[model samples]
Target: MSKVVLITGGSSGIGKSVGEYLTEKGFVVYGTSRNPENYKEGKFPILELDVKNIETIKQTVKTILDSEGRLDVVVNNAGAGITGAIEEIPEAEIKANFDTNFFGPINVIKAVLPQMRKQHGGLIINITSIAGYMGLPYRGIYSASKGALELLTEAFRMELKDFNIKMTNIAPGDFATNIAAGRYHAPLLDNSPYKKPYGNTLNLMNTHVDNGSDPNMMAQAVLKVINTKNPKGHYKVGEFMQKFSIVLKRILPDRVYEKILMKHYKL
Candidate 1:
């Protein structure tokens, strides 16, 4: 029997790409969307699931288990993006981002763990952001939310070791997707102190996503991770420089790296 895979946020963007690719490769794939009715023609079945709602997540997982009898893999790809100066971004928005990006994924994992533990073997791949490795000026909230998930996966892996379930994170750099369209952007108030710099950084961030790599690259990477016998705790996929930036952060002094980022963003 083919392995069953569940990908959250699969209505479009990276999740859609990964689900389609996996389906082509003979895996049983089910993707999730808040409004499943909107994606009636998806390559694979798109279930109704809002990661923020624990009840929906439970129902979605139960639906999968009832039909498939087993779920071999799960890709926690549901997340929201928020961009603005840390000071300018509202507390509600920050918490909301964490709700979707961090807490949501954790809830999904919690809902599925019992079944996965019963199966004795499963893979949980988290779709984090390359930005999670380092804080960006305007996208700090997004970075922090994803970063928290990254760390959470590390701890989760160790805890699940005894159950034969594996967990890993795949951090992707900017990908050409509709993420920018859905991201919450704090209004650029004319009199706000961060107006000029925040506006510039926000524009740059969108451009990077607009010109980013194809989502297929991430799909290919996900397939590779799923096929591995003992996957690493973390994997970074993207342009050379984007992946290299993570390395640079490791080797460079904190202030030096900060300077490079500031200069690159023209902050």
Candidate 2:
């Protein structure tokens, strides 16, 4: 029998590309969107899900289990981007970012882990960002959210090791996606010292996103994890410069890395 896979945010970008690629490889793929109808004609069947809502996460998992009998892989790709100075960011927006990017994946994992445990096997591929390794100017919240997710993935990797389940964080540098359209932009227009810097930095950030690596490239890298018997804890997916920055963060001195990030963002 073919393996069953669940992917959040599958309507577009990396998620959509992964769904199509995996389906072509003979996996039974179920991709979720808040509104499933928007992708009814796609290669993979759509499931209506809002990762923030626990009920939807549970129900979507159940729907797939009811039909497929087994779910072997889950890709947590659903996320929202938030752009703004850390000071100007509202509490609600911060929570919203974590709710989608952090908690959303956690809820999905909780909903599926039991079944995986019973079967004695599963794979979770989290689409984290290279930003998670270090904070970027005006995108601090996004960095923090992914940072939290990465740490959680690390803990879970060990915590669930005995259960034969695997969790991997795919820290992608940038990929062409619509996250910018949905990102929460801080009101740095007036009475804020960050107005000019925010504009310049945010513009540069969006350009990287616009010109980022292809989503298919990410999906292809993720496929190897799915096929692996025991995957590593993390994988960085992107171009050389992007991947190199992540490598530098690990080896370079803290202050030095920060300076590079500042220069990169023109902060």
Candidate 3:
């Protein structure tokens, strides 16, 4: 029987690319999108899923399990980005970011654990970000969300060790995706302290994302990790992110890392 893989947020970007790649690799792939109608016509099944809804996640998992009989890999890849300085963003915006990026994945994992644990083996690959490793200006909320995800991934890795389940966090720096232009931008308060100081940082973050690495390369990396006999707990993707994480780990200590980050953003 073919291995079963389910990917959330598989309508476009890295999720779509990974879904296409896995389907070509002979995995029985099931993809989820908020609107299944928007997905490109393909051989694999595309189900309607909104990760923010826990009930929807449970139903989606149950549907896949009913059809596939066994769930081998679950990719929690649905996430959104919000940009603006910390003080400029409203409380609602911050909560929205956490709900989609962090809590969404957590819900999916909780729903699929029973199926995976019953099978005694499965892979849970989370699409985190380089920001999860280091904070950046104008992306405080997005960073916080991914940071939460990184912690969850690590915790699950250790907790699921004896269950024969593996969790991998793939942190990609930049990818040639439309997410930059389409990122959720929070309204900046005129009286906000960050309005002037963090303005430049916001612009830089937007520019870099608009011109990142190829999304397909990220998809290929996903395939390699899943196909490997034993995947590492964390894998860094993208040229810039790979180099940045290395430099942060080497040249700068914990306190100095923040100094360098602030300097780079002119914060």
Per-model TM against the reference: 0.99, 0.97, 0.92
lDDT of each: 0.96, 0.91, 0.84
Q: How many times do residue backbones clash in model 1?
A: 0
For model 1 the TM-score comes to: 0.99
Alpha-carbon lDDT of model 1: 0.96
Candidate 1 lDDT by residue in tens digits, 1-267: 899999999989999999999999999999999999989987899999999999999999999999999999999999999999899889999999999999999999999999998989999999999999999999999999999999999999999999999999999999999999999999999999999999999889989999999999999999999999999999999999999999999999999999999999999
Tens-place lDDT digits, model 3, residues 1-267: 788999998878888888888899899999998889877686677898898888888888889878778999988889998888676677887898899999899889999998889999999999998887766678878888998899888889999999999999998887777786557886556877777766677677767777788888888988899888789888888886455765775677878887777777777
Give the candidates in order of lDDT, highest first: 1, 2, 3
Model 3: lDDT equals 0.84
> How well is each residue in 1-267 modelled by candidate 2, as lDDT tens digits?
899999999999889999999999999999999999878899989999999999999999999989988899999999999999888888998998999999999999999999999999999999999889888888889999999999999999999999999999998888898878888998767778889999999889889889887889988998888988889998988899888988798899999998988887777
Cα-based lDDT at residue 32, candidate 3: 94
Lowest summed lDDT across 10 adjacent residues in model 3 is found at 240-249
- Order candidates by TM-score, high to low: 1, 2, 3
Q: After superposition, how far is residue 110 of candidate 3 from its true place, in Å?
A: 0.6
